[model samples]
Target: MSRHIAGDMQRYNVRPNCISPFAWSRMVGAIPTDTPEQQARVEKLKKLGTKQIAPLASDAAADVTAQIFAVHGNEIFLMGQSRPIRGMHTSAGWTLETIAGRVLPAMKQNLYPLESSNIVFS
Candidate 1:
């Protein structure tokens, strides 16, 4: 539930909003299939990302390349550094267990009224 900006685009100063994470909705660089553990897991999965978020891409490339998808409850957020990122809000409260186990981690920093740069929302 965080909207952060890091890795793959280390040239920028934006931090991954894991405190709120933002990343490419599509693939940007070579998909890191470096470790056996990662390859084993990727070998079985089809789509790299979720249905809601847009695939992340790299500016250094010509067109949309690989996709890096994200899943956040009912929706997904796309990763485009040049543009503003967005996320959907929950409609109801949840159980304490759910909050402790699930909800709190995804709780996003207020990203509204996109004027401020500290929390460049998505």
Candidate 2:
């Protein structure tokens, strides 16, 4: 979306960017952790999330645009756009059963951990 907007507005020199912030706002405070391990993880995350997000004005002033930025505490992390990490191709187009039983299992190492589905609000 940011790239599209920046491209469309390039003639006007308007810049657009995306912010992915890790902050301990009320929403983070509201997260419920069930186990000690989960709680510990949450607490550690809280440290990284302790600072408030910086305003986009500074980023604009710095002339940074059309990029994804991860704000962690006082740090400003400029990230490249997302791209595919890996791909798998089969001569026979995959069927539901094959994908579920073979392809997905092969990709298990790349999957993110999902300890508690209830932790995420959406």
Q: What TM-score fits each model?
A: 0.20, 0.53
- Evaluate model 2: give its lDDT: 0.69
lDDT of 2 at 97: 93
What C-alpha lDDT, on a 0 to 100 scale, does residue 65 get in candidate 1?
Answer: 29
- The global Cα lDDT (0 to 1) of model 1 is 0.39
Q: How would you encode candidate 1's per-residue C-alpha lDDT over 1-122 as one tens digit per residue?
A: 22333444445543333211222233423346688965644443333334333222234322332233334434454444334454334567667776666655655553344452113322
Which has the greatest TM-score? 2
For candidate 2, the per-residue lDDT at 113 reads: 82
CA lDDT, every model vs. true structure:
0.39, 0.69
Stretch of 10 with least lDDT, candidate 2:
113-122
lDDT of 2 by residue, 2-94 (tens): 577888887786777778776666777777789897697568567765344556646534565687866766777777786666678889998
Shift in Å, residue 67, candidate 2: 0.8
